[model samples]
Target chain A: MAHILVVDDDEIMRALLSGMLRHVGHTVVESDNGQGGLEQMNAYPAELVITDIFMPEMDGLEFLITLLEKHPDSKVIAISGGYKAVNACLSLQMAKALGATDIIAKPFHTAAVIRQVAYALQSKTIAYRRRAER
Target chain B: MNASQSEQIQNTEEGYPDFAKLTEMREELGDHFLLVMQHFQSGMLARPQKIRQAFQNNNPEQLALEGHSFKSLCRQLGLSQMETLSVTLESMGRSGQLDGAAPLIERLLAYGLQAHCELQKYCLACGKPSSVQ
Candidate 1:
């Protein structure tokens, strides 16, 4: 029920993620790369973001850092298939350090995606509630 | 899996593009499954040209991009063999090892064609027009 931003350089991935999110009743915004993702975020200001790690123009880690810097409250899910030159765990760890709320590896299942999104959104909601109480 | 991939795997013990997995997705996604398949089919049809153009130009960066994109698409669709091949091609491109990339690229293209055929078959089975070229 949240507005979600899905970013990936692959059209198939963008379509698939957005489709999945929309199927679950989330409003979805899609972008082809991180720059486009940043622009979309500026325009739409989604409650959650799901992004791929490796992309042209700007990759996921940089995007995560930039997003969090601009909107510290932004909830992000970093997804990557990883690189042969870099360890997969390391890629994910970097994403976490950069402020991703969750990480999903490539070859992920639909249930896992839904679960993570829900968890991230719930976490955001709880955090917002706590802040409002203060 | 595409028909060729299914056949390739059937000859062995595994099937590319796991129909069982896709079935689960279809059940969860309902009508959206058609949209997913349609988008995937379009990628399968359009990407080979981009890959070929990258090869013709001997552009490792372009090849790497295409390889990475192909790998992601294949992994999402459960095209295991093609995913593996794309990963290899992606690495080769990234590491500036383009000399041996031609053979792999050819194989990748073949797998794409096979997957496209499979998409056609799937559309037919579903009583819809083929979404792929």
Candidate 2:
């Protein structure tokens, strides 16, 4: 099982995601806001990071940028409810461009998310294998 | 599209029952029913006490904050009825209508009980005994 970090400003969202992740047999660490999320990532490395776009203190984009700077190999799954249309769209595009393995929209279907997470983990394994070969 | 056609189309898309989606999520989350239960329990236990305290102190701001938090949690848990009640409570708090909060609080409590029962049923079905918080 992979270690996963879930970050969202909404407490319920965090709880729901954490419950889902933990239920799937993955270890989950949660943070209520972007800044705290970033801190947790640095302190406790996770194989995957799932973050919400709009948040207090630091937004998801800023967190993503900082995270990549520190750990380019980290896999990220960005999620958003599209509450902020322009910003969310832009951030999603940026996340894809910055090498996030997947992006799931908010109110996501559970199976789709699970599939995407599995795909990302598999891809990460492949990348690590290639790196080892090099 | 004409108004009637547009309305029909909107309803068709929006009225798709969420049961299938919820079921898929439940399966994907595997045995993590316990975590969801814990979240529901925390919300169920904390919200009423916070609301009661706010009412006793006559603190509208605190009431509004608590209502907002409760509403957020309800929405997250897919507790639509409770979310609606919490929204009404939030509005009353915003308007400083403390007298209007009691009925809304009662409705919220009723919904909370319903949610608790639903969670319990889910646990029992999973062969896990309900653990009260």
- The candidate maximizing DockQ is 1
**Could you give the TM-score of chain B for each candidate, in order?**
0.80, 0.72
lDDT of 2 by residue, A62-121 (tens): 888788778778888988644322434666777777667788865566667777888887
**What TM-score should be assigned to candidate 1?**
0.86
TM-score of each: 0.86, 0.65
lDDT of 2 by residue, B59-87 (tens): 88777767766765665456655655665
- Give candidate 1 misplaced runs (Cα > 4 Å): A125-134, B1-15
User: Which CAPRI level is candidate 2?
Assistant: acceptable
Model-by-model lDDT, in order? 0.78, 0.68
Measured against the native two-chain assembly using Cα atoms, what DockQ does each of the candidate structures obtain, in the order listed? 0.56, 0.32
Per-residue alpha-carbon lDDT of candidate 1 for residues B30-51, written as tens digits (9 for 90 to 100): 6677778888777776786687
Worst 10 residues of 1 chain B by lDDT: B6-15
The per-residue C-alpha lDDT of model 2 at residue B101 equals 69
